[model samples]
Target: MDGGFVYGGSGLSTIDGKGRCTIPSDLRSTVEASSNGNVVCLARHPDLPCLMGFGTTERDALVTDLKKQWEYAQQRGENFDRQAAGGPLASSLTVIGFEASGRFVVPPMLRFFGKLEEQAFFHGNITNFYIWNPSILLAQETGFEMQKEIAEYFLAEAERKRK
Candidate 1:
């Protein structure tokens, strides 16, 4: 990639019959830089109707964070079973390697959950990217009416950061 390739941008892509989709070049570069080789990790977002991708370093950090959260809940008298809470997150996580051509396949279950068929949408979110089924993503938006909501959120976040 040319220097200064920005990380956060949105784009569209299509999945082949084999469930392979090419990672956007900039995103791919970032993933490769952080990962040991072409391997990247995939996991279900705990709450969102989307998947999360992580490089080696990112995955380690995430595991640490989850452990901390589990411990915090334990101290708060919440009956969060450590293994029970961590098992799903751990089991759902898989490491995948990009093909020589920069394509990676989403596993079958993730594909079904993502509802990704012929087309997929890629939205870069700084450290990682979100692969979304276009229809599902669009359904979450309020169309043109989202402008007010977006602006309010942007302003509120900007103000909060200023404090």
Candidate 2:
């Protein structure tokens, strides 16, 4: 993917009873550009409590990266468990389509994995963005200070809107 198609910025969206949430505008535009459509690939983040989302371009890149890793391991005469290596990226991936308004239904398994509920806090991370349960994000410790701050800001904005 081109650097211009990177995901960035942050926002919040309410999850309705049907599990629908609107992707933030900036992130949505990036997804459309990188995917060539409104489809997104979502999966449980390998090391985070949130879910990670990306366009088809990133998904293809993951395949390329895995191939490179396998080749590197073969050259060193090391055994590479292809299944173990690609499981996280491929196993739970779910492809979803959104409307022009950016609303999409979060699959049940992904919703559970992400611990999402009433609201989702979106934080962009260059190649992909994270969809976090607001409370889960706020409760996180250590290296997530910036993400926590962004979640808080959006939470506060939502609160203000309600007032």
The candidate that achieves the highest lDDT relative to the unseen native structure: 2
Give the per-residue lDDT digits (tens) of candidate 2, residues 102-145: 89999989999999999999989999999999898888777889
lDDT of 1 by residue, 1-163 (tens): 2223234554556689999987766677777777857987877767667676767777776667778888898889787666776776677788999975668888998887677887666666666667776656656654423423433443456458669
Off by over 4 Å in 1: 1-7, 70-80, 142-163
> Candidate 2 lDDT (Cα, whole model)?
0.91
What overall lDDT goes with each candidate model? 0.69, 0.91
| Cα lDDT for residue 102, candidate 1 | 67
Which candidate achieves the best TM-score against the true structure?
2
Candidate 1 worst ten-residue window by lDDT: 143-152
